[model samples]
Target: MRAAKRRTSREVRTGNRFAVLRAMYALGTPTRQELAGATGLSFATIATMVTELLAVGVVTEASREDSGGGRPRSRLKVAAGRGLLVGVDATETYVHVDVFDLAMTRLVHHDHAVGEGTSDPDRMVGEIAEGVRSALAAAPDGDVLGVGVSLPGQVEPDSGVSLFAPGWGWKDVAAQALLEERLDLPVHVDNPLKATTVAELWFGHGRRVAHLVTVNLGTGIGAGIALDGQLVRGATNNAGEWGHTTLVMDGRPCRCGRDGCLEAYIGVPGLMAQFGERHPGHRYLEGGSQTHFLAAVREGLEADEPEAHELVELFGEQLGVGLANLINMVNPNLVVLTSWAARDLGRWLLPVAEARMRREAINGSAAVVDIVTSAVPTNPVSTGMAAFVLEGFLERVGLPSPTSAPLRRLAEA
Candidate 1:
């Protein structure tokens, strides 16, 4: 049997530092004592971590907290201007990049379009690199810590390889290495489900729930699951491919060459197919832009068009059925619909989906789960990728000293 790897002192220290930093980031400015309470670390350890953060200019001292007794504790916050982090969201239609500061404030957003079948590994890598460059160009003065990218389909977490991206026709692609080489920066890659889920966990409805599932609804469909406040990555890091599950026998053809898959009925393409069937000669259909088609559908719905209402009602019921299965399997307290498709159609879809979900779900599970639309104001996948880059930055901020050389150089600059 393979031996397990033990945690080194540096790793332990890094984890401790991240814990402290994450607590402060989430709780706003907090005293060392409060950080200790939140992270369950000793007060001395929190103090040491805070000192290291301060030395690196990654954190700054804020107003003192009233202790309600002696010795007012000084609050510390993550410094918003220390450095920048880049997040790349590579979807089927576009490669979107956003630059953010240490405090998670978005500084710039850049998007590059990808033509149909622009799935060559080299081309995708180049497009993503260009998008990141465009975003970084907007903030030339800040120190960019690292880049986190969200690629569609299955990704090998440890090696950062695109194991199998069906839409891109990529298998065993060295995505991380290629991106790092192209951009000359550290790159971390994962799928959209994981990225969007992390964003929801940090900034959306999942923040208040221990058991949460974030459903990614876009050109593709999947789920990102969290149980007991921990992200669930199954064996081989492919836990959330819920889109390929069989929803009906001999129903619709799926991209995975499967019949009756959930995605075939509810994904963006599936919805477009339904709309095309309803209105065989719509102008938006001729343009072949899913975005334009969805917009037109929304317009039609607002105008009380019978076809649009019928399509949405059917779509909602199908979506609810899918959610019911997911809820039954995960038994999560909350399921948040996220990504572009949900953001665009949520207001019209949520009520019908929820009602159908309750009817289809097991009564006990349905009673506890609350299905809601995403609350994140930004692109969730990109925002989550930024959070990932931030975590990586914090983990290695001061590797060998009170202030790492990199941080010192950035601060001096």
Candidate 2:
């Protein structure tokens, strides 16, 4: 009976160790005292866990800091080159794959286009798997902790299944399992917007900001909401579908079977369609149309072409109205607009949008929220994807102690 009790006690200790590790990963290096405070575990317990983690090379200690009043205290941080995390962004037109170190730095990145209207789930998975293999070949000799795939659709996180992605024509596919089987590593799958939001919260401008909204205006327009420091994923993990928000009662038909959605007005296809309608002679070279439009907008502003200026102003107005609704509803402290539209339009688009937002938002003071474009101009999505993987790693191993009030609350939940 004594032996049996010893075994049970050891099992409990092991479980507590895992819990503490997770807390540390989330906090990103905490002193022993801090770890204990965050995890709600005793100092003795944390010391034991930290010892074990250090023994296994999962964590390391930094130099001691002089406290001035007492013995110097040593800081602890997760070792940076210990492992790798994979990120995959499977979009309608292309598949972007990247590998990152524990610090969220991209080590390798590759992109390949997928044929339009291609709905073969198996083929898509195969292509992604190949990309992963290529990334692994380039990665340093560290163990891969996991692979995360971001899809532009509703995802059931628990099940790792994509419910529906009209853009990619995917439905009820177990993407996580497929990748896991192929890669033999832990797999996490989530909506692209949510994953991007997570990336921002941890590594981008959203860091340190409690409430923020990220608007990704690419082939499609989508919003990712972070409320009160937590991602607000609704019942179906589809809360931030701001693209389908109707701007006009019956203005224009959207691909999502809606009338006058923001996407119908601002999405890539929508913008091109509008341009085509107005300028019949305008021809787009392969993959050159978006660039040409941006050039036109730039030149038009300088040339004072009434037609081009009017088109851009209208685009900004519609975007501003939609953003105003979001600001009023979420009251976020920051709004990040990303994509070719925001990047290309630059200051030409923001002032007008800011004006409209000031007029329509609940808080007439637009000063409350800082609206900005993405800092990482090239491969923002891929960089964000890499950051997402880093976030998972940090959550599992680098956070503060679990006994602290803030960390305790997060752990308990």
Candidate 3:
């Protein structure tokens, strides 16, 4: 009973601290009274938390804001200089990096593309480490939380081993350990689709959504499923590999050695291939210009070109059918689309997809589901890498615990 009470007390204190932190983050520079009002905590509690925050350098007091015809109130603002965060997206063809400060303001970012026949794990890890160091050099301060990496595979929890990346033909790579050893920083690695879902929750549509499904429509298709405010990681932490699901009978070939997979029909490469076939003499294919291809397609779609419109409608219905499968399976409340194909074409395809999804969903489940398009600014996987670490940062005061990882003392570095 005494131990139980101690545990309860600790829970209350932790909850109170998070409430204060979140309120401060949301309100920008708000006074203690405002924080109390926003969080429904007592003045004393707010004062205690503010004192703790100030002592820990998480927040700083600012001069009173000018109030028209009223007494000015002193405000507390987050200390943007407190520390830094680094995020890395270890993608198939590139290593994208972003550095952020305590306030989550992006300070520096860059992309390093992997050349053809050069997607080896050692070289990619070196690129990521070099990218982080380059981004860190541009930061205004040296204090860093840690590095978070998003990769395209099933990741081992707390261990940076990528079990497999079928698309890249990579398996059993200790990316996290290699990075941590060289960079000497806390490195958290996760699947790109899962990281995207977490990023949506932290900074996009998933904030207000309890049950959501986020689809990534890019070079390769994938999804992340969240239910009851928690991401659903299958037994192997690869639950949302929906792209490989069979979509057509004996259709286009996929890299996964399968025919008729959703990825075979709807991903950017597949669509581009089909487009090339449609207009045999089109230069977009010969030039390999995805930008021009998308622009031409969008122009054709807006002009009501029969062929372009037919392609859009057919793919929209197919996507809708895919979503209908998800809806029927999980009945999520919101469906968010992101990535190159989704972001570029989702605006036009959403309505048609949603309509077909409604038509195909069983027992009117689609009525409760809301369809929307969203993306993390700049890069989702990279931003999500930081977001993954940020969620832990928010729950605590600052920096990862030394015991969390061997190379965890980033501030000292």
What does candidate 3's lDDT look like per residue over 1-413, in tens digits? 23322325555665566556655655678898888876667899888878877887878987787677788777988788878888888765567899987776788998777653456777778888998888888778767878888877578756669887765677898888989987998788888888788666556665455677888887678889877545677667788989888888898998878899998888767778877687776644555655556667777777777767766787798899999998898888888898767766776898999999999999667888998887456577777778666555644555221111110111112
| Alpha carbon lDDT at 157, candidate 2 | 69
Candidate with the greatest lDDT versus the true structure: 1
Distance (Å) between predicted and true CA of 353, model 3?
1.8
lDDT of 1 by residue, 23-104 (tens): 6766788788777777677889888988888987889987887788988879788888888989889988888998988888
Model 3 ranges off by over 4 Å: 1-56, 59-77, 249-251, 287-308, 391-413
What's the distance in Å from true for residue 334, model 2?
A: 1.0
> How does each model score on TM-score?
0.89, 0.78, 0.78
* Residue range with the least summed lDDT across 10 consecutive positions in model 2: 399-408
| Better TM-score candidate (1, 2) | 1
Give lDDT tens digits, candidate 2, residues 389-412. Answer: 544554466532211112343423
